[model samples]
Target: MTKRTALVSGAGIAGVTLAYWLTRGGWQTTLVERAGDLRSSGNPVDVRGPALSVAERMGILPELRAVATHAKAIRVLDSTGRSVARIPMSSRNGDIEVLRGDLARVLWSAGRDDAELLLDDTITDLRQDPDGADVTFERAAPRRFDLVVGADGLHSTVRRIVFGPEREFSEYLGLYVATVQLGGAPAEPDEVVLLNVPGRLLALHPARGEAGAAFIFRHPEIPGLERGDAGRQKQVITASYQGIGWRVPELLDRLEAADDLYFDAVSRISLDSWSRGRVVLLGDAASCVSLLGDGSTLAMAGADRLAAALAETPADLGAALRRYESGHRRLTGPKHRHIHRAAGLLVPASRFGLAARNNIARYVLGR
Candidate 1:
């Protein structure tokens, strides 16, 4: 039998995991990432449900636990910096939450030796036939592979090249967020301080030897901020969160010099199907629940599942791709349906909504 070859785009949790599993399953895997190097700046993400099993199976659960973000409680405050409530985080919870960068590093460390990694490059075009896909990269020579997987993320380059425009599949949740690395800690080591003013939420949590400040606010549409312009993004964030009270001004003051900034609108990707012929989509590239939901967990589990499906039918590649999509839809469809409701709770639409959320939180705390 001929050896199988695969090109996995994006060195994120999903892409790395997929490449790892594929290589272990006796297939040649090449991983490509547009970023010059692995990203070390991101919010802490939860590892639960199937993702926990995947991590344990891969032998990284212990490492993840060692570096877990011990955020014991979330201290919520009113607009005036008054303590409204404190929601205790479950220490013995079935899940583990670790910084995204830590998790990415662990996954990459585990797979880098096995898979070929191409950094600072991306696929510009993909032409697929009955046999394989001829992929064209922006900075590398075009290569033919038995399969092409797009784990690039919500705004996936592979998706745009193969599927139609992004706007056609994007579902915005009317919220925008800007998370920047804080120069110094704003709260206790194991605590997350949060302040809300109507539709906006400002939070600071400790991770990666520093603190990260995240600003989530209600935005009806995409802002006028240009892509890749951190200055314009900072201005938009400042304008959007101008009168949010609390320690926001201080945080914005810190944002001016912060280089690691992640800003985007909360959105979901709903694709009728995640694959076209020999090319397939994985993780956020296929179905993303965005910043407000447990997308990282889904991405990890989805990659493992996709890899398993491919391994089951290495000869019949198309059949394997179909099986993966069928199974993935069953897993992610329900989450996509109700993910917006979760986002609504994260960034309430109005003052009344915010009050209702606080009342609900208070009630829960009383219980």
Candidate 2:
């Protein structure tokens, strides 16, 4: 029997994983990424619960474990760089966390033998028919696929092309995060230090083995800041905690010198259903709970579910899409809101909220 063709958008963890599994299931897989090549960012990520099961199935669990960050346990602190509370992560069961770069590499390397990866290209225009969808790429000729999946992430182009404008479903979770990598090494031992102030949280996470440094700062909201301009986004974030304390001054100096920075308003993607006809969504493109723990894991789990569904029902694309959406959404949808609410308390709207949170941590949540 002739195999069906599947097209996946975005190259981040979700898209690539889907392409990987679809290939194994005897389907022709093509992944188109907007970026010229694999970014392989070194952001820290975790693989928890059944996510490990999927990795095991992918046969890369051993390699992923080898590259796991074994990040130092999380430390919560006060404004003056003083430790206030701590969470022992080693206590969690069956949890494996690794840098985002490692996972991306693992997924990419795993799929290299089975899937067709299209880098430096994008699906700029799409048209669907009763039999299939016709996609026009920015760099390639038009093509038809039995199905299209959006693994493009929160600002999913596939979602926009198939669903609608992004703003309709993505609600800002009342905070923004500015993350950057500094080139110069600090003259001190690297550690994760979190310092909280009213309506903001500043954190310094030293990169593994002194490769570089990572800084994260959070604020409730920035009303008029232009989100599209990268330079301006960096400026607004730097101004948010202009005089935070201790190493902050030196850190900002390093940030200005740094060229590559990652910044985004912490937000979640909410959709009633991931499928609209033959086109479906996955990962952050479907339900992004930005920067929250386990969200990406959920994305990976969704990829496995999606590929399995397609494998089981390749002859009927409609049945396959419905099955994938039903099973996967049941597991992931509600968690989106839970993450949003928790983030709100983590970085409150005012001084009162901040104090209340610290008090709760010191009294109620403390062990």
C-alpha RMSD values across all candidates: 1.7, 2.4
Q: Which candidate number maximizes TM-score?
A: 1
TM-score of each: 0.95, 0.92
lDDT of 2 by residue, 22-80 (tens): 88888898999989889766666788887888888889989987887645555667777
Any idea what lDDT model 1 has?
0.83
Q: Candidate 2 regions off by >4 Å?
A: 184-191, 211-227, 359-367
**Total backbone collisions for each predicted model:** 0, 0
lDDT of 1 by residue, 1-367 (tens): 7778999999998899898899999889999999999975578888888888999899988898898886878877778987777888885546888888888999888778999999999999899889889999999999999889999987899999999888899887777778887866546787787788777888888764578888888766754442548888888788888976767788899898887788876778988888889889999989887564377888888998899998898778778888888987877888888877786677777789888887777677622
What are the lDDT scores of the predictions, listed in order? 0.83, 0.76
